[model samples]
Target: MPKVISNTSPILYLYRIGGIQWFSKLFDEVWVPEAVKNELRAGKIQGYDVPNPADYSWITIVNPKSMPSEWLALDLGIGEIAAMAGN
Candidate 1:
């Protein structure tokens, strides 16, 4: 089974465009880091129309055990960093 580790933007944009189900259709499992989940939750709290990862059965929330020190030097959002780290 193939899986993909996703960040926040793809999920957000896909959900907005009513294409979020493509994740389940394309991959056996959609893995999301905790940071991605948090970002979506924060967006929802801000009243934006964000889909909750928990709402999708195929979306699995994963917390990376440790992030690479090199990644901390890059200018990326926590969700992106976490997704890469998870990968």
Candidate 2:
């Protein structure tokens, strides 16, 4: 079994399609950065249909100790940068 670090979109879309259970089936562990969790929470707060990571036992939230300077230069979302940096 392998572990995976996921960003907001994949989890969000999969959840929307009602296939979120596939994550546990395909991977031993599914990790999401704090930024990703926050993004989902924000969406939910705004009245969007978003899945809360805490609702899923398979999902784990992690925060990167530090971000790389090179990655910071790129125009990417916080969740995207956190996912890459956490990995």
Candidate 3:
């Protein structure tokens, strides 16, 4: 299925600011990666706040087919990679 491939920036930003519902309103489902999850945890451990959105259910994490490490490899980054793979 063609879905949004979300990342850490938008999730954390929205969460901390308590704007998660808006994310749900904008996309059918918001997705993240393990890398992004790890980053979130690291922020929490470092005493950096996280956006909880405890009641929000639209956000999720998915590991797609492997991708190259460097963003430069793909002009549009991994979201583009996953979108391409969907076809």
Q: After superposition, how far is residue 14 of candidate 3 from its true place, in Å?
A: 1.6
| RMSD in Å for model 3 | 4.6
- Which runs of model 1 end up more than 4 angstroms from their true locations? none
The weakest ten consecutive residues by lDDT in model 2 span 78-87
Give the per-residue lDDT digits (tens) of candidate 3, residues 1-87. Answer: 345656667777777687767777777766666555666677788998875423357767666666645644766644445433422
lDDT digits (tens) for residues 18-78 of candidate 2 = 9999999999999999999999999989999999999999889999988989998899999
> What value does the lDDT take at residue 38 in candidate 2?
97
Q: Model 2 Cα displacement at 85 (Å)?
A: 0.8
- Compared with the true structure, all predictions reach lDDT values of 0.95, 0.94, 0.61
lDDT for each residue of candidate 1 in 1-87, tens digit (9 for 90 to 100): 689999999999999999999999999989999999999999999999999999998999999889989998999999999999884
Cα TM-score per model: 0.95, 0.95, 0.66
TM-score of 3: 0.66
1 against 3, candidate with superior TM-score: 1
The clash tally of candidate 1 reads 0
Clash totals, every prediction: 0, 0, 2
Best by lDDT: 1
